[model samples]
Target: MYTEQGDPCKVLKLINSDIQSPQEGEVLVSMMAAPINPADINMIQGVYPVRPPLPAVAGNEGVGKVIAIGSGVQRLKTGDWVVPGHSGWGTWRTRALASESELIRVPSDVSMATLATMAVTTCTAFRMLKDFASLKEGDVVMQNGGNSGVGKALIQLAKHSGLQTVNVVRDRPDLDQLVTDLKSLGATHVISDAFLRSRDMKEFMKGLPAPKLACNCVGGKATADLLKYLADQGTMVTYGGMSKQPLFIPAGPLIFKDVNLRGFWMTKWNSIRSQEERQAMWDELCDLTRKGVLEAPKHRLVPLQNFEEAISKSMDSFTNEKQILSMGD
Candidate 1:
């Protein structure tokens, strides 16, 4: 990794990497694809968990092939495809070395991009639904930045679990188009911030349902607005700050409504689940995707060689879409 922000990230360029020939606990992998998520850049800027040592490789998650196996490794063969864990492996390169326990196996039918997208969003959404809110089917949820990767995943998961999502977004002139996009992705309801704040909006919401969960990725005023609509004893899970401000929750909601505000970060969340529980969740989620109940997120794949251009693209204006970094020729 480079020393400072905006610095180039060519920490190691071994002409030939030799992390292979794993010992009993380790496995060797030839990585295929990794998504460069906003969290990845946040790690690059020294604002994320799982920071490696200086001159260390940096990447959070990726899909790969088992090129070799360590001694006594019974779970994987030379041809298996796996997705590495949530911490650093520096997915920008060819080879990977990690313990067999670290890999999340995927079927041959799953695309590399799908594997890459599944880790953070799915893990966060799953925990947010099950752990934070103790969500029941027919309960409603609301979230800001609903067109985001995690937002889309949340939408599908909420629908599959017999829950509803009232997605919040900023007002745009082409907002109808955005609503249509989210609805097609299984959103139950979409409301602009302005529409949500008006007096008539509460009357409108009263006719359907009040959310038991408010998922906040955007902070500042957006988060405050969502809190207004939460039901009694509702929980709000804040995972991101696309708004760059600390979340502002009104005192009345917490006191009068008995709403609970919580936080979640995926890396630590995985530590709480048993291996079988993790695998079971993964299998069910993949089954849902395979059944067309969930679609893999939309992303622009950027080749690794164009790292600078990709960074620029990620920082560009007018993009509700996220990009994934790939090892394409």
Candidate 2:
């Protein structure tokens, strides 16, 4: 399958692309499902760091069924459902070819779309909460872009881990409905960007524990304000810069309060980790998913023929959110 790369006519064209047979330590796969995350589009525009060859089959993560396995490969076999890493396995087609090391075999019962997105966002959320911050019960974390794929994953994971969340979103005419929806999904305090301007915010936070960490996806003053709300020894991890502006970290948070600022990119870590470690992390995430603690990010399925409209919709995730694309039901 081939895809176009431009603003007005971003067409993901399907053609008779040959499926290269698996070499030693490689596998041949038939695509079952794929999730069209925002970073996938950014790569096509040359804005994101991890670039596949141009005119690429454009998808980051997806579940595939092994049709054939190379001689040296022992872990995966023909007919097994496996999910490859987010960098190279574009799942916008009838079949996929990938390395045996890149595949994470999943159980037959789990949804294929769930397997697709669990790689990047869910793993990032787990690392942020457990490895990065060491969040404890009763402690608080705050973030913006609360409806994003990563943001929604964080909300579910945090709730499962016995933590409280304060989510920030843009003001809308249906603000009350939005807050209610977020609360249902584990948000304790859902407020608009305008709410950040209130001088009494510190007072509003007086009753709750000071935020131990702030996860910023929406940058600029919104990020800085989240910093101002953190406790004396808190940390902040930034993953996205949707605003396309420089992130302004406030001096006082660093100088007096000792807040640590850091950035996270899933592709870098996924590339560096060994196969055993990657599979372990994925297994842990799957356990949570099996227990119903995590849910697949909202999906908008589109047929391979309607790739243009699907690309436009997924690119607009900042306002209207969707994930997962495949041949329609």
Candidate 3:
């Protein structure tokens, strides 16, 4: 828990606290694992849009097991595995008293890490694919930040939907290996930001359909590149701005190509969507996971006591592996 917002590694302190019995409509959950997400870091820094009260526990996503359920709790029972139905539930702790409505019970057979991380990245990818455009099999989709957790999900989910993907990542020292890895996850094409802007991109575009939809997580020039190649009347959805730079879109695309620009926030979607709608999406994603169509991104399992190390690794530049805090007994 942290008393004030600041650097997560410096501000977050571990402490023991008494676990309380569930009140009416509440359930006691034993948190199994939670991944260190970029949003979690931003929230601790007090920059994210959603700020829980200060002196708050620090996590927005994780999986837990229902250890006990209080009176009036009907949807979940002991031994049920669950993920937060909404964000900002403070998932860093080993145990929590959560209202039954705050958690969504999930299948117990899936791996703990996948269950912990899927609620955010996988769900975001699923929503974007379904909500933004009327894409068909063999239609093309493009996204920046292709190696990120959400980007990886986009590739796999798009592949499973019978659509092709053009994934863009920052140029790295081990670019060749990264390309191979993304392709192995079903990315149809993986290119660096530099490659996306180069003349050779025209030749590459000739082989694939112009993307009917482009997903932008990294804003600025990378996003603009996506717009340039978008099919006429296509849509571009902005979900994150990792570049910390405002979008500088050319007027031509909107004026001449009839391109559409939009934005999405998973947290906002969760708040506004009906429970049944949310459950349907979760059921579909869980089904895909069980069928081997969706795989967790590369990750390292660190015990909860080693949260400092995990946070440090997560903050490192260009770190690809997710750091999951394992809290299970």
Candidate 4:
């Protein structure tokens, strides 16, 4: 736990504390595994807007098993797998006491890594694709940060819905190999950031319909190039700004093409949507996972005791591997 926010690697430390059995309407969960999300790191550094009180837990999402249920708890039972539906339920630790309402039950058949990760990337991807665009089979959906966790989810989910994706990634040494990997995950087209603005893009897009939906995680020029491919009156939903650059919209698209700019925050969506609405989305995602359709991102599982290494690795900018805290066997 951290008393003050600064650098996550400097401030986060392990501490042992006793946890009592669940109270009324509560459940005791033995955390199985939790992913180290960039948002969790930002929260630890006091950068995220939704700051928990001082002396806060470091993790926001994970999968666990119901070990005990309170007297009034009727929804969960011992051994049922669960994931926190809300934020601020510190999941880095071995166990947590949560209100039954704050937990979402998922099937045990799904891998813990997959379920642990659904709260953020999967949920965000699902919402952006479903809510922001009225897309159907053969529709084109484009997104930047193509190799990111959310971007990976968008690719798979779009394919599952019979939609095609034009994914954009920053140019790198292994660009060709990365393109091959993304294609295996169902990306219809994958291009480097530089290619997004090139005349070659026009040739590549000739046969494809103008993308009716665009997802931007990297702001600045990458986002602007993404907008260039959007169909007339199309919508671009911005969920993250990894480039740390401001999004500048060119007036040509806004005035002549009627493009729409929007922002999405899963945290904000969770706060406002009804429980039923949230569950419905998860239910669909879980079904996809069970059917071997929605795959989890690549991950390195580290024991909780070695979390310092995990935290350090999470701060890397270029790594595609996700860090997961393995509570125990």
Best by lDDT: 3
lDDT of 4 by residue, 53-152 (tens): 9898889888999999999888888999998887877889998899999988888988889998999988999999999989999999999999998999
**Judged by TM-score relative to the true structure, which candidate is superior, 2 or 3?**
3
Candidates by TM-score, descending order = 3, 4, 2, 1
Note the Cα lDDT for every prediction shown. Answer: 0.77, 0.78, 0.92, 0.90
Lowest lDDT block of 10, candidate 3? 108-117
Report the CA-based lDDT of candidate 2 relative to the real structure.
0.78
Q: Highest TM-score: give the candidate number.
A: 3
Question: What is the per-residue lDDT of model 1 for residues 1-329, given as tens digits with 9 covering 90 to 100?
Answer: 44443333433233344564888967888877776677777767777666666655556777788888889887888888887655665676667777898887777676677777787876677778878777777889899888888898899889988998899887888899989988998899998878988888888789767888889998998878888888889888899998789878789998999988899988776677677777788888778778877776777888766666666676654466766777653
> Could you give the candidate ranking by lDDT, starting with the highest?
3, 4, 2, 1
Model 3: per-residue lDDT, tens digit, 108-179? 888788888898888999889999999999999999999999999999999998999999999989999999
lDDT of 2 by residue, 105-209 (tens): 887677766777777767888777876687889899998888777878889989998899988888788888878777777877887888876866778788799
lDDT of 1 at 126: 70
Misplaced by over 4 Å in model 3 are none
- The lowest-lDDT stretch of 10 consecutive residues in candidate 2 is 1-10
Off by over 4 Å in 2: 1-8, 317-320
Q: Count residue pairs with overlapping backbones in model 3.
A: 0
